[model samples]
Target: MEETRVLLRNKDVANMVDVAVSMEHGGYVGLRNALLMDGAQVIETLRDSGLRGRGGAGFPTWMKIKFAYDAGGTSKVVVCNADEGEPGTSKDRILLSTDPHSIFEGMAIVGKAIGAGRGFIYLRAEYSYLFPILENALDSARKSGILGKNILGSDFSFDIEMRSGAGAYVCGEETALFESIEGKRGEPRTRPPYPGTYGLFGLPTVLNNVETLANIGPIFANGVDWFRSIGSENSPGTKLFTVTGNVHRRGVFEFPMGTNLKDIIYEVCGGIAGGKELLAVQTGGASGAIIRPSQIDIPLDIDHVASSGGRLGCGTIFVIDDSNCVLDIVKNTLEFFTNESCGKCIPCREGGVQLLKLIKKISEGRGSVIDIDTMMDLSNTMRETALCGLGHSTPVPVLTSIANFRDSYDRHLDKDPCSKCSPERGLK
Candidate 1:
């Protein structure tokens, strides 16, 4: 399968981060073109391009912008979610490091489209190393008259500031991110007045992930048809997937939305590490459902992956090889959500802890059929009652692993455990 290099096109270009170099290679053309058109026209073009939110939710980008625009208020804001905290997801970090200017340009375009004069980049603390690079990029953009009041001699004015998160995985949720930016404890606000109507200091705000915003520059640079021509009808254009765990070539790879999972694993990533047999893959991230070996041919689009009970979350493809135990992986994944739970909601707080304990019991060969049943029930409860996506989606790996590999769990309950999972044995 051939890879499309839209976001990663200038990755290998020398001095790619330099503002002059970026401008020479069609950097701010989208913003410049967008500024010339009416805000509604830009939104219409995005809608036609079939550009959905790249931040796992798969919401239409134009709808979000239009909502903020229609909400009708002053002090509207545009936020670029750069807090790439999901495990195995590094596409945003790479984009911010390599093409910071493009993101700034995208945010500016979004600001102009939504009638927002202020914007923010909510950066994750883990990627603190890229702080200076982004700061330098912002400085360059401001000096070039791309940011600040009266950008490029236009009536519109927009400027962006960067904020660092204090390492909370749940903060990846937009509302929680807004709270963190406000210097409060990071916790998700109940929705009803969604972010478009009321967000960030109680004003209308348009929030999009780094990758989603980055796509704006190109969508406007080339016509909407150009973007729609690359991928499937439902999910047009290329998406960056961060492939890791047991893959021979583990890094960010850009491919069309409907690219085959086999192509990504075998063709693009050079197959499993050490040529080992693939046991399963967790598409999206830790919260995403597990994909069995039989389902490796499924398309990687949002709708297609959802049909298979998975999500294209943050585009993190975590591969598991035959040498590893699925139960162990589930346990680790649940443990992460357990520790990261904000304790704001009882469902997530208690449910995550209970799930972790159950997985620990099962992994230690003390589980029974009843324990498995209990896990399913608890997962349902969490999914139904949890306040935010963190708790609601935390049981995905556990449920999918059990559904696809029940024998692995059953073996742990047997009097004579399988040699592969025996106490004397350890992961290879």
Candidate 2:
């Protein structure tokens, strides 16, 4: 019924000074104290909290742990999936920059839960700025006996190491992430042998997104009902959304899961810039579909977005104003996919470039009526034939654009003899 209490305050500012001060003043003391109790107690507290993965998937965090623990064996490992390469997304970056300790605490809790002696955070190399901050936090945690051998003076010893990724977008995939960490070329592996079953040097491993682990502290401090009460029946607790584009108040907003998109765009984000009419919204990053103006009233949550033909992916809300040409956006997004594709799959690597070529021709006024049909067919091929989710879900934006804004595409096809496409005409 009410909003969840803010656990990650002071995230916007680059004030690691305050974070360091907080950790020194017993910031993760609640979790450190909990490690004194049995590990099952911690898992029970997490289950009660009903915390779901903040990554696009929205899987339950506690259930992931239960699976890892039940798959009984030695050489169990825990990994923090900090490879946040999703375009139009920066929530995980903020978490790492402002509150790295929360992530560290969560990793330790996870290690304790699954009988893992070691944990590694597979972070992206782009944020080279935060490496020192993370190192400092780890050192501070170790000095206080919260991390390292005999954590909190108990036999349960847990330590976390930071490993920066090589900045490949495909590495964001769970299997690819494991492969990258193992010193292999960054590429995705086939599923069925899920990370829960066999991961990180052939052992049962648990991997969680940065924000999902960041919520672990509060789950222990507060009850599950308290967390569940903040959001809808299905999607509970607060989520961090990276709101950008031509908007008046463009930044991140932490709101309950089921908040209405219209309210967020108009009220929370201070409406579109210059009072421009809202064209559509890209709910997820590059991998998500676009929501037209007619669908603005939909709730902003995983199930709600999915039912409405969208995904509440990695929590990015890029508002598209009417003045911007839909074709131009398509070109920009296609170029991103073209460059980011790992070439492991033919459909994504080749098909993404081919899609860009078609869009480039259309944007330059050399497109045809048949190009539309060709684009649709290629999208279907990529979706069905691709090996991993990256290649499979890449066509969502273009397909959704065609479905919602067909007239825009039609305009490009039936253009009059004008400077809009003439050699003399300057690109808009």
Candidate 3:
């Protein structure tokens, strides 16, 4: 995996969170340059840069801004999704902890591009430790004339506030995050009136993940060609992967997009812990699929990982070792989704519960082949009928685990439990 440090360029810089230190290291240059150009030019530059949302969806950042720009609403808003809920994903936390000013700058740029005045950073409860740090950053920017009215002596005035989530994983979804920000139950709203057209108190809103927003400042500072030259044409720029679980050197790693998963695990992460043979690897989060060892060489991009039956969701790479049972992993993943389901849609709410039950049954040596078929059918139904991305993605782990490790599932179906079925294996 080739290292191209765009977002993490300042990772090693001391006192990066301080406004003075950040500015000294070429921090607000992007925003200052952006203020000189027309808003449309900023949008065009983002389009040419081939920047996509670092969130699980991987939607083009320019298209999203274009929708909000074309909507042309007066009461527009920008939202920064700091709710880093995806399992094994902590890159956003690192970014917010180290370089929060970059996200604020990005949000300000989005405000300038889309004609918005107010922005909100919907932070997750677990990451509340970063709240003071981010709040101080926002205060510093405001004190330095970069956040309040007439920023940088320009007529564009924008300010940002932080909102902490109530520990709801579903709220990580854009619409649900919006709902939570509105003081409503954290549930996904029906689409059609997407965020661009109608969002954030029924006004046009542009919401982006923390990492997605982090990319904006660099793109404006370095130009499109400089940004695009680092990664593949389809998926440009570096990606931050939170490589955890069973890896010797588990931490956040930044590499050019489309880098091979094998290199990420073996080279960047220093291979599996204790020299254990690599089993299956989960590329995304709990909602992501399990990639078998044979498919480890697939590029870690949105399209390529999807092509291999996984997603580059939040860039979380969970390295599973040979000692872990696939069935147990699936059970724990299902349990997470089951506990986190918002119960807004039947497919996710009921389907998650049923999937957990079936996985538990199989793990306890009480499952039949019929149960496996039923799980497949139920997963398909959930994927097709779920209300939001959360519901739709809930069954990915179950389906992928069964597909890649059918022998594990089949072994669980045996009349006698396998030796690995001990209570310590995480099965009740």
Residues 8-103, candidate 3, lDDT per residue (tens digit)? 888888877678889998888999999998879989999999999998899999999988888966889999998889987899988888788889
lDDT of 2 by residue, 1-428 (tens): 23243555646445443445656544676576567667677778777777889888888888888877878686688999898888878888888877777888788888888888889989888977877778887888788787889987888888888888888888888888889989998888877787777888778899999989888876655556777778787877888888889789887778888888888888888888997888888888877888688888988888999998888988899998987777777777777888888898889989998888887677677789799899999999999999888877778888988988888888887564323223332223
Pairs with steric clashes in candidate 1: none
Candidate order by decreasing lDDT? 1, 3, 2
**TM-score of candidate 1 against the unseen true structure:** 0.96
The lDDT of each candidate is 0.88, 0.80, 0.88
Tens digits of per-residue lDDT for model 1 on 108-212? Answer: 999998889999999999988888788888888888888999998899999999899879998989999999999999999999789999999989999999999
The alpha-carbon lDDT assigned to residue 65 of candidate 3 equals 90
Cα RMSDs of all predictions? 2.3, 3.2, 1.6
Q: Rank the candidates by TM-score, best first.
A: 3, 1, 2
Clash counts for the predictions, in order: 0, 2, 0
Please report, as a residue range, the 10-residue window in candidate 3 with the lowest summed lDDT. Answer: 419-428
TM-scores of all candidate predictions against the true structure = 0.96, 0.91, 0.97
